[model samples]
Each structure stands twice: as structure tokens, then as C-alpha cells.
Target: MLDLPPDLPRLRTLRTWHEQCLREIDRAIAAAEEQARAEQQAQERRAAATPPPWMVGLQDITGTPEELHQGGCTMWAHRRRKTVTRDQARELLAAGIRACEFCKPDAELGFL
Candidate 1:
């Protein structure tokens, strides 16, 4: 609750006050939007700066590693994937797990 001044009895004065309030509200909205944009940009930067996992192990229905893919590979549509470390990826590739043709993790890890 705000204590409005009783002296603003004139229609012109009230209209002026209303315009000022609208301007203030617009300024506040603009400031909030700017802050939101800044925050979203910061979030995007953080996501971009964060590196993807080095490798991803594509698993079969049995939950066994079936293929190796580079971290950024999107060719495989199956959701049965697990993040793998460099060494793990190498071991899997060396164990004869087929590397994804789209994102050759084996070649990336010198397993080609």
C-alpha cells in the first residue's frame, strides 16, 4: 500500500502522474528483460565453453557396449548410451567394438 499525496486533485496532475508511473513501469520491464537476456547469454557461453564428453559408449539392448562414438556424434538414435573416458573408449575399440562410421572415435583415439 502506497500513501498517495492528497494534493494531486487536478485531472492534469493525475494524468501526469499516471504517465510517469507508466514510464517507470516500462523502464523496469526493460531493465528486467535486459537482465534476462544477459543471464541467458551467460548460460549459453557456459554451455559452449564446457567440453562434451570425450567418448560415448553405445550399448545394446543387453546393456553391453556395442559401439564407440565420438562425444559429439548424433548419428545413433538409441538412448542406450553412456559417457566413456578416453582410456575406456580406447579399450572398447581395441576390444573390437565397432566405431561409429559417422563419428569415428577409433580413428580419433588412434585405434584405426
Candidate 2:
């Protein structure tokens, strides 16, 4: 610990000034962080609005080139998705859709 001189008023004034300076520094740091966050959010929003080229069907889901084949029942090959689940596959097969042999919709074949 540091000891202050016997001047009580001067010591109090110094402490007050030190506290005020600390508050100002904190506020400046907070403002900078907020601006950075806002810019990052704006970039994200722009990216979401534009979307990628692969995404042609769903919101962000892309279709595979082999979707033209796989003649089965439900027409699963026609609809492309970002993530294909086991249940979705079954549903498509049950509906008369078939999986693409060349593209292999299950694996990473036609996925752009």
C-alpha cells in the first residue's frame, strides 16, 4: 500500500481525479467495442442477404447436379438440402424417389 501526504483535501481530490479518469477510459473502451460489434453484425447481415451461388433451392441449401437422375418414388433427388437426414432419405424412398448413383446424395458428391 502507498501512503498519502498529510494533506487530506489534496489526497481526496487526487483520488477523485483518478476515479474520473478510470471511468473515462472504461467508457471509451466500451464505445469502441460496441462499434466493432455493430460492424461485424452488419457484415453478417449482408452475407445472409446475398447468399452463395450453390444455394439455389432452399434458403441456403444447394442442389446437386445428379438430382436429375435417381428415379425412385418421392422425387428426393429433385429437392436438394444442406443436410440430408436418414429419416428424410427414407421418406423420399418411400415416396418413390431414388438416390443418385453418380452424385450419391448421401455422401459428399453433388454437394457444392
Candidate 3:
């Protein structure tokens, strides 16, 4: 770094520009945080809605395809879910869609 002259007036202007850049960065960060919160609220609303009766269980990489859980089953919280109509549920079960033992969706569908 080069030594500046003692009477250099550029120092004040540079400091002002730096502060303006910092303020803009802070505003952008706040906007991003607000957007994230809004998205989270929307997701929560979707989760609160009543789930369909027949659900398909989500499969994870390298894991077996587990049985589908009932809509109101507590185990649904830990897995991803897909909603299915009553008839579709029956068809799925008939086609070898396994039912969760805890929720026993097959029994709920009169299959068991």
C-alpha cells in the first residue's frame, strides 16, 4: 500500500462510498430473510390442510419402498407423502402397494 498525503480529501469520499455499500448489503439481506419467512408460512398452511385418505410412502435413496401410511398416521411426519383417492388407494393396494403396519391403511380401505 502507498502512503497517502495527510491532506488527501479522497479519504472522506471513499469512506462515504463504503458506508453506502454496506447499507445496501444490509437491505438486501433483510429482504431475503423476509422472503424466506413468507415461504415458510405458506408451507405451514399446506401442511395444516387435511391430507387425502390414501397416501403413498416416499422412498429414500438406497432404502426399500416401505408401505404407504394413512393420512392421519403420525409416521407420515417423518416421510414424504403423496395423496391418493379412495379408489386409487384400493387399486394401489391391489397392485401390491404395501400398507404401513402402524397405520394399517389396507385395513382402513377394507382390504384387510
Candidate 4:
């Protein structure tokens, strides 16, 4: 067991010091949390500013022509993909880029 100091002044001083340390620690944690929140908001804004294109075409490993798909197609989960504009998608389709069987980009583009 720890022995308590008989002098009240010393005990009061120690309590005050402990409280101040705790307050400082709390302030530091709050500042770190605020910084994290600001960073996440900035990232969200950047993502919103440059939204993904409406259409995308998955390319082969060699970056050669491959299947065309919509932006949210499931086939692209494991495939390499690149975003393309609507006109570019049409051109790629014309260039024999096969439409994704799942998303059916051809029907969405009124090509079907």
C-alpha cells in the first residue's frame, strides 16, 4: 500500500498536476481526431470532384483491346479497366470491343 502525504498542500499540488496532465492529453487526442476528420472530408471532396466516367472498358494485360462494360459492371472486379467517355465507348464498341454480358453496355447505349 502507498503511504499518503500528511501535508495537504503537497497532495493538493499533485492532484492539480495530475488533472492538468489529463486535460492536456484530452486536448491532444481531440486535435488528432479533428485532423483525421478534415483529411477524410478533403478526400471525399476530391473523389466527388472527379467522379468515374459513365462507361468503362476492361483491357488486357498488354493494354490491348478487350471487353467494354458499364461503370459498375461486376466483370471488372478482377479485370484491368479504364474509364471512357460515351463517344469513346461507342467507338470502342465499333472497334469490336465486346460488351459485358452482365452489365449489357450495348443495350444501355441503345445499340441493341
User: Each candidate's lDDT (Cα)?
Assistant: 0.78, 0.52, 0.79, 0.79
For candidate 3, lDDT tens digit of each residue in 1-112? 9665466588777778889999999999999999999999999998888676667776766444456777888886877667778887888788887888898988888998
lDDT of 2 at 85: 49
Model 2 misplaced stretches (Cα beyond 4 Å) = 1-5, 54-112
Candidate 1 wrong stretches, greater than 4 Å: 1-26, 41-51
Candidate 2 minimal-lDDT segment of 10 residues: 51-60
lDDT of 4 by residue, 1-112 (tens): 9676889998999899999999999999999999999999999998886635445544565786588877776677676777788898888888778888988988888777
Rank the models by TM-score, top first.
1, 4, 3, 2
**How many clashing residue pairs are found in candidate 1?**
0
Q: What is the lDDT of residue 52 in candidate 1?
A: 59
Candidate 3, superposed: residue stretches over 4 Å from native: 1-48, 62-65
lDDT of 1: 0.78
Please identify which of the two predictions, 1 or 4, would achieve the higher TM-score against the true structure.
1
Taking every candidate in turn, the Cα RMSD to the unseen true structure, in Å, is 6.3, 9.4, 10.1, 7.5
Error of 3 at 7 (Å): 76
* Preferred candidate (TM-score higher): 3 or 4: 4
Per-model TM against the reference: 0.58, 0.44, 0.50, 0.54
Q: Which clashing pairs does model 2 show?
A: 72-96, 73-95, 73-96, 73-97, 74-95, 74-96, 74-97
| Number of the candidate with higher lDDT, 2 or 4 | 4
